[model samples]
Target: GFAGNTIPIVAGSALLALRALEEDTKANGKITITRGDNPWVDKIYTLMDKVDEFIPTPERDTDKSFLMAIEDVFSITGRGTVATGRVERGSVKVGETIELVGLGNTRTTTVTGLEMFQKTLDESVAGDNVGVLLRGVQKTDIERGMVIAKPGTITPHTKFESQVYVLKKEEGGRHTPFFCGYQPQFYVRTT
Candidate 1:
């Protein structure tokens, strides 16, 4: 437990840290980043209002069937390979059958174990980040961006139609139109 050091720094310190992280990230990879000024700097109340307007409280659908996006995979000695990721929907428990779907393959596997933060769990629900030990799959076969989901729940595709929103120039965004094959970067847990 991180006790005193575990807590997060906020406001100015957090903003400064974001800038520092941008530089560190660029050095680690052949990527470019830009850290812009916070229009709400020193304006906590206004920022809070904007946050409330834009983002709402998260609602986890534990009642749905199991779903987890595979963020990583690794093998344990004698225990089989593990697919690790957050439960985007529903819940999963030990000994249940699951399907690994996405990235050009689909396979059925049993959940031999479930773990989080070095602790073994009987079940993990929506919003719970977990690592699932699986039987009959190789760590080399499963890749990131795949889903460990309930059987017949997910449909994988190489392309699909989607709606997009482009920000205006005033909000530090360009009003640029996208052309064919204009791929954009996405972060972790993108559905």
Candidate 2:
């Protein structure tokens, strides 16, 4: 029962922390993050009517934007096609098929399921959640986050243009009002 005691304690702590975080997020709309930023969490900012965007500076300045490599692909029996991880721009919708482009190759698949934030939806657009599924293609062909899109819609590019912005901070270690024309890292999604 040693593991049980410790596990429940940890679980309870996590639940409480999550509750507090949800409350804080509701009241403030956004949390000032310091490390390990999940672009999805910030996606809410874009989804919500609150503000425009959150920009992060890249480690180095270069014309080529980073591409998420495909990790793995899955083919569920009778469930259709689905891809996991490496989410780029836009959203993946259930029953809506998209093209998988990368590695000097491209293919098409229909979305069967879109899972994000412990919630499953019929479709997922940009900033929806995470785990996306499609209809066509096989497990051997696709990989994780392989930049799914509509055929002929997008092409693999080493370089792209993006607009970056950051929240204005006040003098007392607080966020100031938002403004336009601010320069910051541009967090972009490719699909």
Question: Model 2 misses residue 116 by how many Å?
Answer: 2.1
Candidate 1 residue-pair clash tally: 0
* lDDT (Cα, 0-100) at 117 in candidate 2: 71
> Tens digits of per-residue lDDT for model 1 on 22-111?
665787774243334343333444446557775687999999989999988898988889988889899988999999998777889899
Clashing pairs in 1: none
TM-score for candidate 1: 0.60
lDDT of 2 by residue, 1-191 (tens): 35544332111244444555676678789655422353444443334423223224333322223223344466667775556665444444456656778655777666667777768877544333366666656677765445766556678765667654543464343365546985443333433
lDDT score at residue 37, model 2, on the 0-100 scale: 51
lDDT against the true structure, per candidate, is 0.79, 0.53
Candidate with the greatest TM-score versus the true structure: 1
RMSD (Cα, Å) of candidate 2?
18.8
